[model samples]
Target: MKLTSALLLIFIAVHALIADGTVEGKLSVDLMKPSPSRPGYLPSPTKHPVLKPESAPAIVYLERDDGQYPRLKTNETAQIRQSGYQFHPSMVAIQTGAKVNFPNLDDEFHNVFSCSKAKHFDLGRFRKEEISSDVLFNKPGVVKIYCEIHQHMRCFVVVLDTPWFVKTDPEGKFSMKNIPAGDYWLRIFQPSERRIQERVTVMEGQTNTLNFTR
Candidate 1:
């Protein structure tokens, strides 16, 4: 997205003027209950899998109001396809005013709908490879989506106001750069877990670190 790139350049220019700093942090979840946002507790595939259950990725962002952020409004669309009887990305974080395409890629019919507080709508059943409709996320919050016929099929669309965000790696680590010098509330959003936040002041050229454990 050219707009997104432009905004990054714009932020860089401003950061160069101010003493802006970078924000690098990590989020740690309980090993006993790796994911708490889903329906119920399910044992990890293997007891000693290559990656620990707590290393699951999560969305990390800054909750602050800069002059203007471009990701809030985008022509690029997000997709949540029902392929192999599951949502491609079970969870996603997008800015407000963005549109998400819910395409049915499976042979069986699927009806996608959400009853989350952020927004609500029902897209009647649609055929394979057919996109029932594009849902506009104008409100900011967590929107839970599901299939009427297939109750097991679910997706989470996280609508946000700030454009400065990135999904954590499997190690639960994330980084943010070119942020304006200021104090902000760093927020972390993980599936099946409550959001975690911490206050931190950013300084130019320096990398700040914040960590969560327990």
Candidate 2:
């Protein structure tokens, strides 16, 4: 009887370890009018207007109520390319301590710099041939990047301490899976918009759906 009880306890522990949940949601926000593309040094013959969502490409993340989470291992480097006098994918989300590379694909020189509290640095002007070194984001907060040479070029990088973070699609749809079942605080961040937060409970082997509109 003692041996049987021990085996049953082990099985229960194993089951708990494998328990996970999923979170999925969508976001709706005011649409932003397309910005007219400025003429670049190497301008193309034809120009196409680019449309974007206001305060968009939001970031959604889950944080445990108890503030217990495993440290994220930094092994991969993210990239934000500079082309046609603009920052490609104007927004990005990354785990704290990760590195980001700003590759200039344009013929003119670009200077990348940020004055945000989370990080402050300036990568002097560099062209396509002389790419600047990668920037390491060690703090958790929003870092707003800009080009010193071009007033129209801008980008935002959100550094999060939690690993359970994902970016919303162009249509505002987002989903995250394989999160450990527990109580957590779900939060969302978007450029030029107010932050949103809410309490959420995750059940083992279950999925939770939530939505936000602004």
Candidate 3:
């Protein structure tokens, strides 16, 4: 009887795990330019002096704004450094209500502000090693972050309603686990890369993979 009960418990646990799904994929940017002659061989620009124009491509995911995924909350902390007169990690993604730490790591004081419709606030000038302020993204949208003294300094903060969202890594890879099985719309974005979207269905104990190129 004891052995039978143990087996039953194991089966129930397995079934519960199956109720959750997962997603994994890679995102990458491709610049369309003239190809060099042979492999690892290119005409010397100094010698040819041919003018080349480059373009930036990007992709953004499309999602519904209805308040869903209540249990998919994630608490995170982020930083915007005042080095090189600019913000490092030009693009960042955070969940709603997550705290963002603005630390001045430079010799000069810095001011951070965002006038985007989604979020609007400003942190007055702050010195090195000091945290200017912390912000909680109450809504989901894109926020353009900038410095008051530096016009060239700019960064992007993507506030998401679901903690399941993640930015692609250096290799453009992203994954989310333990998602309740359901149908969802998946999208990808690159600041200068082409945007792509598709329908995704999450099944029990399965992984979905998507590869996008610009």
| Candidate number with greatest TM-score | 2
Indicate the worst ten consecutive residues by lDDT in candidate 3: 43-52
TM-score of each: 0.76, 0.80, 0.73
RMSD of 2: 5.7
RMSD of each: 7.4, 5.7, 10.1
* Runs off by more than 4 Å, candidate 3: 1-16, 30-66, 71-75, 193-195
Report the C-alpha lDDT of model 1 over 33-114, residue by residue, as the tens digit. Answer: 3323445445323222222222235788897646355553457578987776667677778888888998877667778999
Q: How do the candidates rank by TM-score, highest first? A: 2, 1, 3
CA error at residue 160 for candidate 2, angstroms:
0.4
Candidate that would win on lDDT: 2
lDDT of 3 by residue, 59-158 (tens): 2343544547663445667775657565766667777787788887666667899999989989988878974668888887778887775544667777
Winner on TM-score (1 vs 2): 2
Candidate 2, superposed: residue stretches over 4 Å from native: 1-18, 30-56
**Cα deviation of 2, candidate 2, in Å:** 28
Candidate 3 or 2, higher lDDT: 2
- Measured on C-alpha atoms, candidate 3 has an lDDT of 0.67
Least accurate 10 contiguous residues by lDDT in model 1: 46-55
Ranking by lDDT: 2, 1, 3
- How well is each residue in 152-192 modelled by candidate 2, as lDDT tens digits? 57788988888999888888888988788889999987655
